[model samples]
Target: MKIKICFLLLLFAFSNSFGQQNNFNYKREIIGTNDQWHKLELPNEIFGKISPNLNDIRIIGISEQNDTLEAPYIIHSTEDQIKNVNVDFKLLNQSRDKNGYYFTFKVPTSNSINQIQLNFEQENFDWKTTLEGSQDQQNWYTLVEDYRILSINNAHTNYQFSKLNFPNANYGFYRIGIKSGEKPKLESAALFLKEIVKGKSRNYQIKKINTIENKKRKQTELDIDLGSPVLINNLKVNILESFDYYRPVHIQYVTDSTKTELGWKYNYQTLASGTLNSIEKNEFKFSNTVAQHVKIIIKNSDNEALTISNVEIGGSVYELLVRFSKPAKYFLYYGNTNARRPNYDISRFSDNIPKSITTLALGDEKIITKSETPKSEPLFADEKWLWAVMALIILILGGFTLKMIKKTDEREV
Candidate 1:
């Protein structure tokens, strides 16, 4: 009897584990050729259904023999790829003129350079700059004119935009003119060729926007709602005013929500924080985040609030690089709460991935029906059978307890 009870308990636990492992809420067929490797871009609809970490996603392939196999995949996000090549240069001279300050750099290789990054010791300064390039110091051609470089260092914000970007120009010597009242303290400078590979992205529509100004806190808050939860990583806050202004901006997204008698309460987590200035584009990027509601808080301090024209939010599209062993029909399954992150060899050796592969499309999503029966039926196939098993176990335990009590009563008498 003891062995039977222990066996029943173990069976119950095993059944639960089996169900959790195989149960997935939704699936979509992969509409592509049975290539050795394929890439599938995840649609926006899956963002709301899958886990935030995306551990629940799986690719199941059915072979011609009707055997199911799990395929390993790597999630790839289309984020901007940047490559920079530093050009060795020497500072030929630094002088102050009636205009302001000027610095000359001589490049030995005379490589084609597009960007110059400057570092300064002074914390707070706004300066306009002009860049000129020439093979000889005497003959100079203007590269960038009247470009603004700004830095604001205070208790509330630390921001700088001192990088000068221009078209690729090859010259033996380069001179920079800074327009400032006093001699600007120069720290360091770097000349490099920057190559940016823009990634594929999708912009999300903002369903609603609400603004609130808090005079007491000296802050302006904007509440933005994207109708449904989607993956986002980029935001652009457009300011309408042309006047120069700088403010520290805090970005957050709703993680969870609760409903109460008052209203719906939202819990938010920080996504990114940066300074918003008139000199730069005011665009911010962070890790891909799944959110439906976002909040932006701007620290105005004593400065007047700037008018917001509009806000743009977007994220890089996610793709799955999957390897298929044999020609098989595959289906993408997700929405399993108890799923664990899979470890595969391809994840460790990502360099083996092909440079180019066919991108597969997804078919219409279908919900997995719970009423579908498995190939092999269990002892407790129905709810009534499970209840009956539980009742039998209880009766056997009760009988043993009564027997023990009766034996003890007889001995006492």
Candidate 2:
């Protein structure tokens, strides 16, 4: 691990050195106490008020004036770790007070130090901090001006060199002051910080906000371009499942079809008990009995784009005339086994073999009967009937002759 870290550092040094000018500048950071200063604990008070001692800074609570709201609480790290990191902060509001509850921390630093980077969670309130850098402890330069506001909870803020940089000298000292903007009534604010690397790290801050605001400026902004409205021709079918109309499909309709507007819709009332509807989307539910196929032509009156899903049908073809000012891709999903299906393999339908025919070894009766039939004999060539007729004539003639002979004998007697 040590070797790997060293290798990574070397790689970074080499790569960064080529493209960017290397500030071979490495300086010692100094941490001070009223009695004696420690090298590890720089910026004695982070955002002022709280002790530089890691333990004391961990748990600090601020009280507001005559408002009956709960106060914000802070928790610091244990002594054993220099990289003392705070994890969670819970703000409990009881009664409203004049000033909203908040906490502050003081950070000690070296006089030679230029800037500090702060990574924090909880962006509700404006975080304010002031820096005073000193060498002899007697004279100090107001290194950081005003307070910084960190907005958008679970985010980070970068304080620059100009605001937090100490005066030019060998030895330096600094202080960090913090305050929250919870109005007269005691609102609550909770936050925590993890120290990544303590050095002359550069900060990319929003140009509009001053370092004093302590309000964090983010590096990335979410820009949504809602596309044009699209017409949807969707059909739904219950395959291999016994379903009747009365199952409801929820359609989540949003004014702007973007990531932000993505939400859920339920069709509890529309779906009758014992009925199972497969259509699942936003909020509006469709009845299975009334409509098997539904066509929706969505036009965007709002300048934003529109998206649709959870189209329901009763396994039938629905003809839809879709008008689209913009290009859109339609996503259709079918439920196969109570599970979302796209499982229908196209290859399964490609076999042309008729259903009546079997590919297995089962003998085909139709083919066997046709092949086994013997050829019929011609009528003239059959001798059995002619022979039977000849025998019958002979017998009749013999009987007549015998009868006459008997009569002649009788006359002689």
lDDT of each: 0.87, 0.28
Ten contiguous residues with the weakest lDDT in model 1: 372-381
Off by over 4 Å in 2: 1-111, 154-171, 181-413
Tens-place lDDT per residue, model 2, 286-324, is 222121112222222221222222323221111111111
Residue 33's lDDT within candidate 2 is 16
Compared with the true structure, model 2 gives a TM-score of: 0.17
Q: For residues 88-153, what per-residue lDDT tens digits would candidate 1 score against the true structure?
A: 999999998789899999999957999999999999998999999999789999999999998888
TM-score of each: 0.85, 0.17
Off by over 4 Å in 1: 1-17, 154-157, 372-413
lDDT value for model 2: 0.28
Cα lDDT, model 2, residue 235 = 33
